[model samples]
Target: MTHVQDGGPAYWRVAIVEDHRLQRLRTEELVGRQPGLRVVRSCETLDELMAWMAGGSPQSLPHVVVLDLVVDRGRDADPAVVERLVRSGMRVLVLSAMASVPLVRAMIRAGVTGFVGKRDTEEDIVAALWAVLRRRQWITPELASVMAGDAQRPRLSDQEERALVLYASGLTLDAVAVALGVKRDTVKKYLERVKTKYADVGRPVRTKIDLNREAIRDGLMTASTVENDRR
Candidate 1:
């Protein structure tokens, strides 16, 4: 773990994956100007970034990955790629135009540490990177309300709520089961019930990511809580 002392620089290696040439260059420039931050790699696609990572030494891996959710003429961002990046021990910050609740929830569940809208100011981008680097979660205030749609929030049974909190906290099925003092299969059953309950209220939780969003909305978990669980 590296730390800054005596007001000195704290270097953070960052990578960018954006398809648009102009946007990529602009983002690179913006990131370069930030204190204590460096743009280690800027590529047009996640594949290109992954290929570069494969050829480089582990020490060269970026501490943070700034990715676009939808890249023109390239593979769009997917949860699998986010999961892959998280599994590789890199903090991910999604900078995307798509700020829909579903998309934001999906990325969060996939383990991104922060999200910033494409329309956000350059300062917002820098702040997001700083938050993720500190193991915190950053979502703009507007998106935060979208994630917490209280008026349409669904109700959950005690068991279902417990299951959601445990699962969304990054616990495996077996581990959730152990915590709930139930069998692994029972944990799955509880999760299924929870899913149906959400769908009943017109809030579809079709995947693990959706369930994770619901957990956050239900006050069962926070983004920082999920990040901590992942760590």
Candidate 2:
């Protein structure tokens, strides 16, 4: 409960939001034992954490949340939930047993600062947590490889990727706009920006068909998605 007015807290506050009870306690214990970390909140679900976050005092919230994507009986936590927490001003460090590349990618899009596989050693987890607290991008080697796999592809913001995937998947501009809940012009801008990024990477997508092909190559969509469109 020590809060400095000018400088940050003396120690980092850590919250554990893991559905698995044993894992939750273990993580809580580990973080608590750390020299400069405190286990502020340990809960089974993000909803519980959000409920506790109701006080309107920033001090009530932890500095970083160690979250597991899977909850309840094998249910997956939506990336939107992660995004919400991140937007609330807490850094997120995913600590999940499910090392899914797509899930990691989605969480990254949702603004996760780092990730540590459940199978990773305690040292790795501690290191990842500290890195996140320092605003560093910490990712396991395996997860890093997954992200680096497409390093040659030009990066796009979340909006641009959504626009590319949906528009390239055969949706008209109007439909994409409706789906994204943006104006048609906004959607056009997103797609145009996506095209510019691709072009800057030397893989210009001049047409919608070219976009579809690029999307396929980026694994945003499958070839069958565009292939079936022709028929």
Worst 10 residues of 1 by lDDT: 1-10
Counting only residues 3 or more apart in sequence or on different chains, how many pairs clash (N, Cα, C under 3 Å) in candidate 2?
0
TM-score of every candidate relative to the true structure: 0.67, 0.67
Where is model 1 more than 4 Å wrong at Cα? 1-10, 154-231
Per-residue alpha-carbon lDDT of model 1 for 20-130, expressed as tens digits? Answer: 989999999998887677889999998898889989997788989999888668667777678778867789998888645565555665667588988889889888988
Clashing pairs in 2: none
lDDT of 1: 0.79
Each prediction's RMSD to truth: 8.7, 6.9
lDDT for each candidate structure: 0.79, 0.79
Judging by lDDT against the true structure, name the best candidate. 2
Cα lDDT, model 1, residue 230: 81
